[model samples]
Target: MPSRYVIVGGGIVGLATAHRILQDLPDADVTVLEKETAVGTHQTGHNSGVIHAGVYYKPGSLKALLCKAGSRSMADFCAEHGIPVKVCGKLIVATEEAELGRLRELYERSVANGLEVKLLDGPAAREFEPHVAALQAMHVASTGITDFAQVCRVLAELLVKGGAQVRLGTRVTGIRADRVLTDRGEIPYDTLVNCAGLHADRVARLAGADPQVRIVPFRGEYYELKPQRRDLVNGLIYPVPDPQFPFLGVHFTAMIDGNVHAGPNAVLAFKREGYRWRNVSIRDLAESAGYRGMWKLGRKHWRYGLDEMRRSLSPKRFAASLARLVPEVTLADLTPSGAGVRAQAIRPDGSLVDDFLIVRHGRQVHVLNAPSPAATSSLEIAKHIVAQLSA
Candidate 1:
């Protein structure tokens, strides 16, 4: 019998890993378990769709290194597979004098990451993004956008073509040493990979791996531009991020469909998979509220957390934040959009894991955290995970 590998979760990471494994070992029996009826239903589908330019990560960090390579690879893959991807470029604008210093720092980091970038003054920035207000900005010419759902579908297609089985609506309830207990039945496997996005820690624990870290789901809420207002944004427009916070501030993105989206304030979700304001699960809420990491994060960034909550509940407030970037945007030009849950890993020390966190335990590997650039870096992250696997 061929060696079996069972991977939990069917997001981009899981699909990417399955694809890589089959490519590397064609005879291996691979199975992907997704609780959702379809792939990319969570973060991957609701994401801003920006192909990050690796400007914010620390030099030599896994995120920076992989994002640079993965973004290019993602573009290439999309092109070869006939997926729609637009390399429309992005701008990190410094709207106020206080942000100028940070803008310069991002520019330096972008150069260190070996990406092509140009510095633009306020007027120069306006030349490209006429609606954006900024004193200075860094134009990352390589940043772009794509429909990751399409990418996930292609990945599934490729996996099927390579003879791998993806089992949807199959929830892995537990992971024993040599078997995965699922809602349908037990899957016997020699190797198990945990790519569970919002519940990575739980999956690792189920696999008998003691992951010291915990998965904290942060909800990022967005607003879409009205049909009349889509023309205001030509591409991606971002703010000079606050260095202290892990969440990127509200920004504008010209999606592949030519509509613009803005705001994704990072607020702690009451439920892991909660998107709408009224949706809640008591089990999910207790799980989050009881975690020691949750309190630690709250104690550290209570103010930012409160602000995120305020914005999430009030569209007018969210619109105000977006107006800072595009002065012409009015309350009427905005409408409620879907929210994405970010699986942020909070360490025991109360610090957010900004970089990709990967842990190895016996025959199993767990992805603790893979943030914003993750979608852009899926291919490279897959390669890294495969390389880390002990043969």
Candidate 2:
């Protein structure tokens, strides 16, 4: 009998996995189970859509390896599908002397990762991004942008064409030894893959796997520049991120849709899918608050958390943070856009997971942590996961 594969979640990673399986094992029976009615409704659809150049990841890590390969693969896939993508590059700048050292470190790391990068003094940086306030900058030529939702759509189409099943609105209620119990009914499977973004940990537990990491949802809030002020950004403008924090600070992104976005301040969400402060879940809040990891993290970064909360509540504060990179931007030029919740995995000791984390139990594989570049690295992540399954 042919192998029966069941994948939970319909985000980019899940769809990409199904596409990869069909490409390699044509006769395999693949069924994707998604609780939502549509694919890419969460992180994949809510991201900044930047094709990362492997700049911020540690060299030799899965993120670095997959991101470099994924950027190229994603661009190729986009080209093959005729999906619009732009390799418009990015500038990581240092507006203050203190940030110059970190900027230099990122440049060195980028070089070590074999990426095409160039260091730029302030005036030279201005030539690339005229409005950027920079003491120094590193130009990453490989960074670009594309609509990931479109990519997910095309992947789903390909999966369907290849005779794979995409069962939308089907929620997996339980996982047994050789079958999946769903809200609809029980479905037998030879193998299972969990790509559940926000609730990966819960899904893993259902599959009888103890993935030590817990998923902590962090909401990133964004603002768009008014149409007239869009000229202030050329491509992508970023700050030399604080090495201690996982989030890259507020930056300017020239989206594929011809608009510029700024200031996705990372804040703790009251609910897993909470898009606004008013959207809360008592159960989710209690779970997060009760987690030892959460308390440890909060105690360590309470100051930073307060500042991010301020940015979430104050538009002027958000714009002022953006002003560090582009002085031309002001509160008046900003408008509320959208928000994306990052499913960050945290250990019991409070260290945030920094790479693509995958674990396997018996015939099941769980993607425990895949944030940020997961959208950019979806295709390559699928290749990695599939290769593991074959092994």
Candidate 3:
């Protein structure tokens, strides 16, 4: 008899995993259980939709390897499925002399990751993006943009066509060694994959794995450039990210829809799905506040934390940060847009996880942390997970 596999999340990763399983093991029974009424309602849907190149990741790490391979896979998948994707590329700019060193470091990392990158002086950078202000920049040819939500939808359709089961609004409440107990009923399976994004740690515990990481939701708030000012950003314009923090800092992204997005200031959200400060959950907030990891992180970066909060609450401050990249971008040119909460995994020692974290226990595999590039690397990540199962 074919093995029965149950997937616990319906995000891009879970759907991609199901698609790969059915493609590789034709007779295997695959069922995807999602708590939301629809797929991609969380991170998959709320993200900036930038198809990342193999940039900024450590050399030879899972993120670097998967991102390089996955970007190519994603472009092919999009082309095959009639989904719209633009390889518009990106520029990492340094406005001040102090930032040049970090910019050079990122350029080196990009080269080490085997990506096609070019160093651009201020004049060269402005030649590519007329409105951009920079002393120097790294032009990454591989970076692109697409609607990941559409990708998830296409993956879901493919899974259904391939005879995989996708159960929406089905929340998994508990997990046993060989069975998954859910809100609807109990599901018996030979294998279980946890791709739960926001609550991955909780789900891992349910499956009896000590993942040793806590999911800390960091809300990234965005603003949209007014239609008339959209031309100010030709493509994506990013600052040299602070090596001390995991976030990419405030940047301008030319989304696939033609509107430009700016300023995703990172702040601690009060809830796992919290998009706004007012949307608070006592339980989620308590868990995050009570975690030793959260406290440690806060103590180390309290100043940065306060600044992020200030940007969250003040539109002028947020736009001011964006002005560092594009001097033409004024506070009046921006309108508040959507926000996404990143499911960052924090270790007990207060350090943020910098790579993808996946662990397996007998018949179960849990994805503990997969932020940023996970959506871009979904297909490759799926392949890696399937390979683990085969082993």
Clashes of 2: 0
Provide the TM-score for each candidate, comma-separated: 0.98, 0.99, 0.99
Least well predicted 10-residue stretch by lDDT in candidate 2 = 256-265
Scored against the true structure, residue 335 in model 1 reaches a CA lDDT of: 81
Alpha-carbon local distance difference test for all models: 0.88, 0.94, 0.93
TM-score of candidate 3 against the unseen true structure: 0.99
What's model 1's overall lDDT?
A: 0.88
Q: Who is ahead in lDDT, 1 or 3?
A: 3
- RMSD to true structure for each model, in Å: 1.1, 0.7, 0.7
Q: Which residue pairs come into collision in candidate 3?
A: none
Tens digits of per-residue lDDT, candidate 3, 244-318, equal: 887999999999889899968899999999999998999999999999999999999999999999989888889
- Cα lDDT tens digits, model 2, 1-391, are 9999999999999999999999999999999999999999999999889999999999999999999999999999999998999999999999999998898899999999999999999999999999999999999999989999999999999999999999999999999999999999988999999999999999999999999989989999999999999999999999999898889999999999998999688999999999889889998889899999999999999999999999888888998999999998999998899999999999999889999999878899999999988988999999999998988
